[model samples]
Target: MGLWRVFYAGWQMECCGTPFSVGDDVSWQLLLVPGEEPASRLTGPAGHVAGATDGIRVVQEAGLTVALSEDPEPRSAGAGPADPGPVRRSGLLSVETHGGAWPEVTGRVRSLHIVVQDLARGADGTWEPVPGTRTLRETDRCPKWFRGREFGTDTGRRRRDEQGVLVGLEVPS
Candidate 1:
């Protein structure tokens, strides 16, 4: 069996996503993201032991309708505006890395982790996660997305953990 940590974003769940629980068999499009990416901040260490999957430690649950944007780093230094690419409503999600296709992961949920984080006002007047305020709670039921208006983002409270779901899945070889 192969164990993997999967990140299911709250916003994705709130936006027409089906909720799943522990022990449920599921197939989801998984994006292989580098550990240093911004979105990887929400995930735990990778558990899959595939040799070619290095640097793809973090996997995110990709929605059917995904928003595409131009690669930010490759833009010219003086580009006037960043062009947000057209929305892809392909109803399919997948990624290819190292000349291999990683379309979806089929597995049984072994465990669920709800990520909780404590937020503090940064010097720049933005809410940032406290250095060590991250914790995970084991749960069986999928999370419900709570709308938060304070920071113009969902789960806008100082101390919140009910938004993100980190699923531990066991894939059969």
Candidate 2:
């Protein structure tokens, strides 16, 4: 089961984005979410896209990075290999005991979709969908994303802060 399926009482992850949307590195740079706010999404070779997810209420914009690494990094202490989830370790380098074992791990992204729905926390601190928030779900609530055969670590995003300050960060999974 997916984390969404585990946490969401009733929700769905719909994919309307094709290989043309975010997969084409030559074309896709930015796209606006289909709605009133028209949230502009900037996707990269990395595992996440940055955009405005908050609707009319809060103006909070965030990046939802996905886990995309095939062979995770060996620990500094060399504990053990971890599951390929959110490890953020992808590049043209490796230190695996079986060196270069993941040649197929181009660290490239395939496709992505936004899980649009509101979460409600009860007194027990469990997450459930609000009755009204269910109305927010859609076939394309957020633009579906795809990736080319690019290394996830090879790309990053340039972000400007509230004060118009600019900074760059690696697009991690």
Residues 72-167, candidate 2: write the lDDT tens digits: 234456564333233222121111121112111112222323234334455676644444432222222123231112112222222211111000
Stretches of model 2 off by over 4 angstroms after superposition: 1-21, 24-105, 124-173
> Using Cα atoms with residue i matched to residue i, what is each candidate's TM-score against the true structure?
0.54, 0.18
Instruction: Provide the overall lDDT of each model, using Cα atoms, as 2-decimal numbers.
Output: 0.51, 0.23
Per-residue lDDT over 1-173 for candidate 1, one digit per residue giving the tens place of the 0 to 100 score: 76656667676677656778899998765554333212322222222224323222222222221111222224577775433333221111222222322345678888987766667567787877767767778889776674322332463446444546778767775
Error of 1 at 25 (Å): 0.8
* Clash pairs (backbone) in predicted model 2: 112-145
Q: Judging by lDDT against the true structure, name the best candidate.
A: 1
Return the lDDT, model 2, position 168: 15
Residue 154 CA displacement from its true place in model 2, Å: 48
* Cα lDDT, model 1, residue 109: 84
Output the TM-score of candidate 2: 0.18
